[model samples]
Target: MVNEMKVAFATEEKNGLDSIVSTKFGRVAYFVIVELDNDKKIKDNYIIVNPGGEARSGAAIKAVQKLLEEKVAVVVAGAFGPNALVALDEMNIKHIVLSGVKVSEALGQITDKL
Candidate 1:
């Protein structure tokens, strides 16, 4: 049986695999959510607008809540706010920082760590 997990990348645009990693986690425009099999190969992927990006306050916390709802095992971004990092840690979700790269590149670099 194959165990599957989800990894979400905070992205600047909704360009699928080519989406650029966002510089800030809380205010990202979108999230490129990828599903990976036990072999750490991508099984599926999709994008969603970040509601937190439109928030007036506590964007980082709101972003973390959205990730939790998506059942993400790992989150990738250029940087995370202190609140976001702490929330992810408390939720037992792993986070990786890979800035100035496409989602595809980020995935390649992180697969081995999964």
Candidate 2:
């Protein structure tokens, strides 16, 4: 089970906090993994390229698997595909969606709500 507070943000670029949040979760070029402390502040961050980002099919499944492998407990994106949503549910991963926001902003909103 996911224990650490790791949040994945779907972004178009490989930037950490500065990356722009991507509207498309499965097709996003990168997933910015941010590690949060107990107080909900960012402790560290990294980027992972999506291998199946441009795939015509099964992209969502692959993306979800990748995030799972990284032990992500939550995901932040502008949107999530149907398949991805199902996969996340099965994996017990929480997700937050925010449109037209930067990765940093999305993180703040999610933490505030929690």
TM-score of each: 0.95, 0.90
lDDT of 1 by residue, 39-71 (tens): 888899999888889999888888888889999
Clashes of each: 0, 0
What's the CA RMSD of model 2 in angstroms? Answer: 2.2
Off by over 4 Å in 1: none
Model 2 lDDT, residue 95, Cα: 81
Best by lDDT: 1
Off by over 4 Å in 2: 1-3
lDDT for model 1 comes to 0.90
